[model samples]
Target: MSRPHILAVAKLVPLLLDQLHTAYVVHDRVHEASPEEFAKVASNIRAIVGGGESKVTRALMNQLLALELISIMGVGYAGVDVAAAVERDVPVTHTPGVLNDEVADLAIGLMLSIARRIPQADQYVRAGRWGKEGAMPLTRKVSGARLGIVGLGRIGQAIAKRAEAFGMSIAYTARSAKPDLTHTYYPTATALAEQVDFLIVITPGGAETRHLINAEVLAALGSKGYLINVARGSVVDEAALVEALKDGVIAGAALDVFEKEPHPSEALWTMDNVVLTPHIASATWQTRQAMADLAAGNLHAHFAGEKLLSPVPECN
Candidate 1:
């Protein structure tokens, strides 16, 4: 049997599949297989898919479908047109299990950083501002803080596990309650935010959640709450957030994701109370490699007539 053709669209994490001797299929390029290129390896082409959702759209998707399966590697297949793929009878897969611990670690880190003003303090001391300052709002105690989790998925559970070490009281708002968890459940997000010293968003991104953490929610937390988002940037209102941080509507925020990709509002740049990082909550080397391997495992299973390892049944 001939080798199954695979195209790695995700630019950040390279495919580490040892089972297949593969070549790179750069999606940004206009042609991975042109007339001359196709003529050389036309018969060898089988499957093609990009890393991010938009990476493989109309033409690329159609070409990949004409052959065999087009497997996607990451949990967010916001790129794969599942309805279209289903209509075309193409099997789609993603890597879901690997990044949980990494994301959870980031959640805890961001929460602690925001609560303690770690990043700002670092900047102040490095810039010699501490020499003239009265008292640089030192780190806060995580031991007795109230922790609010926005989503109660696997990553949320992982974060909760980490919080146990800090001796935090956990409270969460899930669409549906998990009977197994002894953690307190609040009927509304406002209730959760109201009760916690820190609010950590672990929810998924999309329209339903767009601007979920807005002025009203921030106001509900009062001036003592800290917001940490390891989720999507769109989940919170960036403009409102800037104003909140500036006016002290909320104590502070620790963000791993932002409204704009690679660009946050300039107004948020210098706030001593805020801690902002590029969207890298799940970017650990070990975790990303595991994700890649798991994605490949799904593809390997699918072609071998085995069950798919992780499949997104429907988008929520």
Candidate 2:
């Protein structure tokens, strides 16, 4: 059998190199790359192993016409250009279902962190700022609070189940309503925002959901409510969110993902109410290894003349 050519854009920190070695996976385990190094791949490489949120731009797709396939290593495919891929007959695959628990866990944690001011309080302790001068504002409870989820996909369901354990009632708005959930289903994001004490965004990030949680929805969540976004930052408007947070339009926010990764706005930095972390919703050692293995499995399938396990839908 001819050896397959696979190019991975990012590194896999948690996955076992030995296991992947035996399976004939050629990967770049070191994620940090200089721009010049990436440019080489941008110019030469054919196939790509990228995050589900990483796009195969028009230029890259042109390059891949001569390559094998692009295997996305995560569940989110907002970065992948499905339209262009189809135009070129290039198959795209995503890591779905497996990362649900990890991402949902992050969502739930962010909800708790913002509501309880966990990150702020931790910083206070670490920086010798706790009880430095005055008493801090009392934190809120995640348990017994109402949670509204924007999208109820696999991760949303997983979050709902986790929230239930914390005594949270789950209400959500989806493309089509889910009638089975005991928790109420709202028809719109606006309605969901108005009802819940905490709003957790588990929706996909794309043109459809871009800025879905805008100033109006922020207003609907009310001054006492908190927002937790473990999804994409594009789903929330940064300027409006900073304004709302500054004025306490909503109580606080906790975010793991951002509209512009590696650099979030300077506005959010001054706000004591917001908790920000680099996008690490799927950063758990075990979970990430699973994702890589699954992505690698998808690539193996395509190269072996078999069907891809998790190909992104042609419609999406």
TM-score of each predicted structure versus truth: 0.85, 0.87
Candidate 1 lDDT over 131-222, as tens digits, reads 88757855678887899999989899999999989999999997878899999998778888888989999887766788988998899887
lDDT of 1 at 116: 76
- Residues 155-228, candidate 2: write the lDDT tens digits: 99999999989888789998888767776888889999999999999899899999999999999999999998
| Best lDDT among the predictions, by candidate number | 2
- Cα displacement (angstroms), candidate 1, residue 75, comes to 2.4
Candidate 1 residue runs with Cα over 4 Å from true position: 15-45, 52-60, 132-135
